[model samples]
Target: MATESARSERAGGVSSLRGLAGGGVFLPGDEEYDRARTTWALAVDLRPAAVAFPTSAAEVAAVVRAAASAGLRVAPVGTGHNAHPLGDLTDSVLLRMSGMSRIDIDPDARRARVEAGALWLPVIEAAAAHGLSALHGSSPDTGVVGYSLGGGVGWYGRALGLAANSVTAVELVTADGSLTRVDAEHEPELFWAVRGGGGANFGVVTTIEFTLYPIETAYAGMLVWDLRDAHRVLSRWARWAADAPDAVTTSYRHLQYPPIPEIPEPFRGRQLVIVDGAVLADDAEAERILAPLRDLGPELDTFGRVPAATLARLHMDPEQPTPGGGQSALLDELPPAAVDRLVEVAGADSGSSLFLAAELRQLGGALGRSQPGAGAVARLDGQFQLITGGMMVGEFAKQTVADCERVVDAMAPYSRGRQYLNFQEEAVDPSTGYDASTWDALLRLRKNADPAGLFQANHEIPHR
Candidate 1:
């Protein structure tokens, strides 16, 4: 993809895209260029030919129309959370919906109508006001539409279906530059495809309406352990997670916290074991169920009643920007043997600072329950998803892909031959991400919806 400056040069040396509605178009030299193009990953750098910050769906439609008429491409972005810096769009028109932030909660119907730019925090806060909750991302800072497009899996995924499953309707700008509303009752096929097809394949999503659940506060937090016991902690978590009840969801992560004053003293500058536990129910029930795991010798136990507003901080994920790499796979089962094998590869003994964090999130339960028109969701029936990610550096920097594969091979005995789209690192063969049946269906849908292959730059899917 060409940069905005390069694209504009080709377009008669014009800086702003003409005929765009409402707001002024941002060109190459604009002061907002840098801030507008940055994403959460710090890896993705997008220099669009122009950025149209549409305040209304009509303005968005205008930008799409102009781009289509000028033979330019449009890639929608939401706070750039899912973006990878290397995924450049030099000649494209980046349609940023960040200015379109709006949240409308219909408590009576237990639903929320969200604009494409609304982050999970707003939705959670809005729903909390009505004693309702949505299947939002573990990190509330993540974009709602982007997460859903990648098949939203959250802390409560075991009890409720994916965030994608909660979608009731969407307003999209299709390939031909038409703004259309899609639902189970309207344009059902497209609706099915967009449920989890990944974004920008079919069109630009402007607004989305999704179902909400009644959950104000629950028992959720992490139990941290010293790196010395990483092996024991990892092994124990594996078995305990396998038999965990539906209401109890947890993920095991081995992380190296930077030596920063903001970081707690116990966790700062050390390889620590953290078990993220969430119970979307009353405190007593959660405490009883989590007691066994809690007794497993944690250095610091932060598990207790906490406000939902502070949920994002519990994970303590990196807030700073840096280039990184990651990979993930679904497991059919994690028996005692499988747990032992995983401990060998990713445990404390696994001599790889390259492995910043490896997480094992328990899957299945409500996630396995099929919903109408679900498309390309990752590991619905799997028992767990094994994921690893870290900053790309030194020899390890160039070997992210190989390391990811190495992790996968080490755990192959328990893997179910399924992959999670979000956790996929660059250089991963696309066909491996989806099962054969899913790959075939995705190809057929791609041929039907985007025969021109305009969105191929963002992802790889064989289109005849």
Candidate 2:
């Protein structure tokens, strides 16, 4: 039963959203309001004042103005893949960008420009049509604007650096409901801040552009072993990742699959360890670089050349909305002691109830070097970014969170206490995602651009 005051508030949200040029708006009590507020991370139940689907940059600006007029803040979202931290939106308008998906590729120039709502799969396929590829993350359906803005680490991360540095330009709606474009030459400060600093900290991005590589295909795949080999396999991967050339980037993971009919035979209800990635080289060269790990004897090897576009789905990340939760940390180094601790906590005998125990990305190489005129977050100052994830549903949701945090806490000694905001599903101090100097500069810029705090972000950088 809705209270009289609550009904009035919902009515106000609807009335203020009138005259939207494209798409529509939904307020509480509306038939579609519940569906509109659902995020990719299904566990997060967002109860915003209202939800708006804006189609164009102009429409986005109008939504912002409407929210302001209605005495509410505006929060922009693409796929809501990392929506866990956006705790309270009761006083805000949830701006869903799904209606604005548009992708454009210039094959000759090896560049791509996409609307804020676009997913990486479409962009990658479009780019691949011209015999090129973009720096996309593991999940093909991830929103390009959000991932690139928050610093994307993918199969080719070590070689190409972050997806943020590759971003060429951004078009957004600012606090005052103005559609503005920023690049290296205009609004350079905001441009720099949004690249790796997370766009919502400033405003709602309408479109974005980034570099595409001249790549058709390469030797890329995974090497799988049973969970019992986690200790030995991960140990080798850590050492290999530390000294391996930048031409190749990889991750070591411990995966536990549920024993269900939907799962395939090989991985169904099985506990396993896998090392997967891409090698930007010919078959022989890639094989040679992977020889050390191959010698260790993997039960299954799926390394070979394939179409560049296929790389988007290499990691087998979910393509649909799923109930999940996770935690992550940037580690300085993973010495033998750290490795032992990780295996002890999440290994086969640990009795941990989690889907993915550890997904440690190999950092350094180009990712460690700061580029000239790069964004606020130039490089990740750590050797590895450790991630832990699990399904958050039913009676196990609380246990899942505790399990993920336990792994992070166990490896705390080796961590630099920093974070890769892209992989972070829960909220933490946004400053931990950037350097001390970078955080300070970002705050100053936020203070100038949005003094009234009219915009809300998942990992908000507090200006006040």
TM-score of each: 0.89, 0.97
Tens-digit per-residue lDDT, 39-94, candidate 1: 66675556777777888888877777677666566778776655652255665777
Worst 10 residues of 1 by lDDT: 454-463
Residue 268 shift from truth in candidate 1, angstroms: 0.7
Q: What tens digits encode model 2's per-residue C-alpha lDDT throughout 1-464?
A: 45778656754765678567364888888899999999898999999988899889989998898888776788899999999999888888899999988899998778898999999899989998899998898999999999999988888888889899999999989999998899999999999999987889899999999999998997999999999998999888889999999999998999999899987788899999989999999999999999999998999999999998999988989899999989999998889998899999999998888575678999999899899988877899899989999989987788888889889999999987898888899999888998888989999999998898889999999867
The C-alpha lDDT values of all candidates are 0.73, 0.89
